[model samples]
Target: MTRSDLNNWLIDLSEINSIYIFSGSEGLWFLISVVAFVWFILAIYRVEKNDHTSIEEELSNPEDLKNLIIEINSDEVDKNNSN
Candidate 1:
């Protein structure tokens, strides 16, 4: 209701637990951050391991190159229409 009431409520809430120990919400956030970081690193490693071919090698076939160009043009047209 009042600012002082809100401040006192916050102070009481903080005082309920010691700052040195991780609260449940803090621990959950830390776990999520660690998992996300590890997942990102693994994804990068997996991509590097699986992707052995260069761009030139991938598009060496004429048909593949033509299809890629057509796909790009279609995507561009769709984007332009959206705007």
Candidate 2:
């Protein structure tokens, strides 16, 4: 479609100020989009919160770091022995 047709379509959409004006499929899709957006935002928030808590716990316990380093070194040694 031409730019004018696209512009007119956008203008028409802008005139629709309420969800009730949408047809069945349009309303369903709009609701689905809103729900998906909220879910995405919540998921991101939860991930960030979990990461901060995990970091704080790791910092509070030095032994975890040492254990992690030991595991890494052991894995490297096993790889070297295999090679």
Best by TM-score: 2
lDDT of 1: 0.75
Q: Estimate, for each residue in 3-30, the C-alpha lDDT of model 2 and write its tens digit.
A: 2223243366766554443334576898
Superposed by TM-score, candidate 2 places the C-alpha of residue 50 at a distance from the truth, in angstroms, of: 0.8
Worst 10 residues of 2 by lDDT: 1-10
| Collision count for each candidate, in order | 0, 0
- Supply candidate 1's per-residue lDDT for 56: 64
Query: What tens-digit string does per-residue lDDT give for candidate 1 at 22-81?
Result: 334667888999999999999998887667556768899999999999999999999999
Q: Which stretches in model 2 have alpha-carbon errors above 4 Å?
A: 1-24, 61-83
